[model samples]
Target: MGLTVVAGMLVVVGIDVTAVQLARTQLWDAADSAALDAADRVDEDRVYAEGLHERVPVARAGVAEIAGRHLAEERRPHLVRSWSLGSRTGSPDGESAVVEVVGRVDLPIVGGVAEAFGGGVTVTVVSRARSQVR
Candidate 1:
């Protein structure tokens, strides 16, 4: 009976851990899509079509604007308690956008346990996508 109880407890832990992983993965996917969308906006497609330079630099304001639209869309379905965009900055190579996003995962089982501890896990992710004029 003792062994069975221990095994059952371990199984709950495993399931909770897996739920956390899945929630984190979903947040990551949202970040990836948002970053890519932002990067695409910052890209110099017109210049590329005109056979111009290879690297397209994204402006600071543009990054925020483009990333804002994508992030808004990303928030619709995910049951994050709350979310924030830490930063949207250009890469060192002057041809990419990096989006840093932080979201709270709200899985009931995990949330219940975390509530006992005063908090749930926050999943933070950074996603980058290159913007090439060529």
Candidate 2:
């Protein structure tokens, strides 16, 4: 009986950890995708003017929209808490842009084993990429 209880507890812990890791992974992937998309649209001619028009905010919004649509289609419920796009500043050779995305996903174990220890769980992911403008 003692061993059985221990095994069951271990299983529960494993499941919770796995869930959290998976959530974090998904967040990172989304961030990467968003960053790349925005970087690709960067306008180099008028770095200040055109770049502002094709800023990280615009890219972040686009990514969020696409991610939301994807989650909905997969029947997953996740909310984006915050999203930010870093500035476009570099040398004359080239420029790099950064996009940061943050999201919160409700885990299945939140009310069960997870709440027993503390509260719910929230995952944060950040990704950065550098691309040369034409």
In model 2, what are the clashing residue pairs, if there are any?
A: none
lDDT, candidate 2, equals: 0.50
Could you give candidate 1's per-residue lDDT for residues 1-134 as a string of tens digits?
A: 99999999888778777776877777778778877776766445545565446756555456656666777876543556777676544444546778777877666555676787767677788888876754
Spell out the clash pairs found in candidate 1: none
Candidate 2's residue-wise lDDT over 42-105, tens digit each?
4434555555432332333344344344334442324333333323211222344344545554
lDDT of 1 at 66: 69
State the TM-score for model 2.
0.57
Using lDDT, give the best candidate's number: 1
lDDT of each: 0.68, 0.50
**Once model 1 is optimally superposed onto the true structure by TM-score, how far is the C-alpha of residue 115 displaced, in angstroms?**
0.9
**Per-model TM values vs. the true structure:** 0.78, 0.57
User: Candidate 1, after superposition: displacement of residue 3 in Å?
Assistant: 1.7
Question: Superposing every Cα of model 2 onto the true structure, what RMSD results?
Answer: 6.9
